[model samples]
Target: MKIKSAEFARGVTGNDYSTQDNLPQIAFLGRSNAGKSSVINSLTGRKNLVHSSKTPGKTIEANFFCINNLFYLLDFPGYGFAMRGVQERNKMVKRIFWYLEFTNARPKVIFLIIDAKVGLTDLDLEMLEIIKQNNHKVVIVANKVDKLPQTKRKDKILSIVSQAKGLEVLEYSAKTHEGKENIFKIIEDLVK
Candidate 1:
């Protein structure tokens, strides 16, 4: 599935426009600086589709992007940013949970992005547990694989897969666009 046109729809902080349209939603989530925005930009074939920052916790709200006018790709705020205040972090996490649990715009599938070099952190594992409890279909995306040495890439992916249990974990590199087609295929299948 090719994305012919992609544009920013809106930035949602609550249960408002996200559910108003009733379009299928695909959520992108990860720890701070795990390259969620970069993966989205790579998948869309748009360099600046979603602003990526070097600083962690820059994406404070859930930004929605319309793809091919068929569905919305929701880029959520990254979790586990130590620099942020406790109150702010709690609020952000609450909002994410609210969207996942109470909102009508529950995503068709969630792409849980993680830094391949770092493997799965404690925060990612916690988020995964909550997501599973909510009964959401989730795919673990091991992003930034290009940074790993070729010899170690396979091993790293294997480690993540084993740690993820039965969940499907795709190898990805936003910089090199590796695994972009596989991700597109997953989205196509889920949206259909």
Candidate 2:
């Protein structure tokens, strides 16, 4: 599953281009500042590929990146950013829901990224429930593992796994590229 080519396809706020594309989509979803963009950049091994921001909730639309010309890596706007206006937050949430429930571009799998130290927030749990209700295949990615001490990493991952119920939780570090290969493998399987 080596990435031979990756490029920004488009960003959509509604059912236009997104629904028209038949390419298999791999969705990346998470809370604001959860490192979704960073993980994408890390996986592609291209710095600035996704343009991670220091500010939370900067992504306003679903951005699609074409991967290896085989499928699309959909980078969705982060959810539950308290700093944003209530109306804006709600709009973003509704957009995500629309994509999940109504769009024709069904993702092959959803990668729910989370901060390893923060574990699963209430918002994440809610999102997971909705995603499951929609019957989408999902994988939980515990990003920023490098921030935690080596001794605490396993315990944190275990805690996340427990909280995630039976869902697969992959320990990841966008900074160190740990668990990148495993994620690639999952993507490979799904895209195939």
Candidate 3:
């Protein structure tokens, strides 16, 4: 998608995200350090549009970025981090679940990001269940494919497919900009 204008809209916390106007939103969901912000920056074609931190679980709020002034790209707070206090982590997880299950502003699609090298984990499976329970269409984004060897790409994708029971998976490399356009096409088709 051509990013004519990508700007920060707002950050949401708790159950009162109703301040946001209705717009087609595409949410990126993942564990801490899974590169949600990096993927957003790459998709928007702006290097620093979304601030990326070297630390894990830095994104505390549900961030909204308006893309092309037509739709929103929500960077959900990363979950499953050990660094955060148990209370804090539970709060974040609850917020994510609430947003996905209870919010009126359902996203057009939820892109569940998985680290290509690390593969899927229990938390990822839990997230998949949450999205599925909400009856939301989800697309798996196998991120950091550039870190894996060329020969392992297909196997990695196949493994995910096997586990997901035929879920749509797209590979992406925020560092190399690989498979970025495919994600854009999916978003464009959904938002249309």
Candidate 4:
């Protein structure tokens, strides 16, 4: 799971997708500002591979990254943000759904990232249902665990798990590098 080399492939929006090579894709998805970029950066040991924006809803495109020349890593636009206008949000929504539901290069696995401290949201639950409906294998990543105090950590994780319906949940912290290797291993297994 050690990533020898990684490169940005493309940024996709609207009805478009990344160039077709049939590389097994692992998609990362979550709520806006849910730490999707940070988790990818942390997992790959590439600090800036994915941009961690200070502004919510900044990542409006689906970014594709070639991982180790072995597979593709997809950074999907975060859902459930209110910062965008109706038309813009509709486009984003359509783009993401189209990629997930209609793309030729379906992801081998979906990393559903959630803010650990914030626990799970109704939207996240909806995404989980979508993953199930599509029969896509998913790994729920609870990121930003570094922000949770020790005493509340267990309860917070439990809260996230309660909503996951028995899907595997990994507690993670980009700042602390916690659960990074485990995430990488999962991706490697899926792609290989």
Candidate 5:
């Protein structure tokens, strides 16, 4: 799908709110600083379309972006940040669950981002479990893959896929636009 235009539509905080016109949505999920924002920006061909934070736990809301007037790309708040207190952490998790389970217009596909260098952390697995429980379609994305050598890329991807239980896995380097087509192709298939 050619990204003719991508723009920020709105930011959502709670699940009680209504979604955007019942369009097919593909939400981005990942830990803080895991390159969720970067991947969104890269996929839409709009640099800085999504705000990436140097400090983790900054995006406390679920942001929605409209892509080429075709579908909605929801940018969910990051999980697994250390600075958050227990209460804040719980709230974040609750919000994530609410969006995944309670929302009526469930996402067509979920782009679960993970840091390529770190591989799959325990938090990532937990998130995947929640996605499975909610019966949401997921695509395990290993972000920041540009940091790894070309030869190691396939190996790392294979390892991550082996670790994940069911979701289809794809590697993306937001910095270099590597694997951009693969990600979009998956999304296109899901949305269509």
Candidate 6:
């Protein structure tokens, strides 16, 4: 789908915050530095529409962006960062869960991004379990494939697909815009 217009709606910390006019949503979930922002920017063809950082855990809020005035792209804060103290980290984790659990608005699909170079981590597996339990339709996007060796890409993709069971897995690189067509096609099918 060609993005006629795109812009950040707001950054929210909790579910109590009201959303804009009703629209279908495609949510993103991943650990810090997993390239969530970059992927969003690339998909919307809006360079730097969402701020990205080299530092992990830079996105602390669940930001929403409207796409073509048709649906929302919810950019959630990345988890699994060690910079915060135990209490702070625990609080953030709780808030994230609260938002997911309490949201009345269901998303069309949830994109769970995994860093291609790193494969899957323990935290990622844990989050995957949660997403699966919720019965949310998920599309696993293995990000940063541009950093991986060509030989390893196929193996890594297979590994992710195996781990994800029935969910479709797509390799992606925000830097090079690789695998964007497949990703968008899946989104269109899901949200249409």
TM-score, candidate 4, is: 0.94
How far out, in Å, is residue 192 in model 1?
2.5
lDDT of 5 by residue, 105-163 (tens): 88898989999888889888888888899998888888988898889878887888889
TM-score of each: 0.96, 0.96, 0.96, 0.94, 0.93, 0.94
The TM-score that candidate 1 achieves is 0.96
Worst 10 residues of 6 by lDDT: 13-22
**Per-residue lDDT for 97-181 in model 4, tens only?**
7777877777888999999988778878877777788888999999999899999999989978887889999999988999988
State each model's C-alpha RMSD to the native.
1.1, 1.2, 1.2, 1.3, 1.5, 1.4
lDDT of 2 by residue, 1-192 (tens): 788999998989877545355889999999999999999999999998898999998788889899898899888899999788888898888888888888777888999999999999999998999899999999999999999998998898899999999999999999999999999999898877
Name the weakest run of 10 consecutive residues (lDDT summed) in model 3.
Answer: 14-23
lDDT of 1 by residue, 39-113 (tens): 999999999999999999989879999998899999999988878888888788777778778877779999999
The predicted structure with the larger lDDT, 3 or 5, is: 3
lDDT by residue (tens digit), candidate 3, 9-122? 998886865534677989999998889999999999999988888999888889999988789999988999867888888888899999889988888899998888877889
Between which residue pairs do clashes occur in model 2? none
lDDT measured at residue 4 in model 4 versus the true structure, 0 to 100: 95
Worst 10 residues of 2 by lDDT: 14-23
**Candidate 4 global lDDT:** 0.84
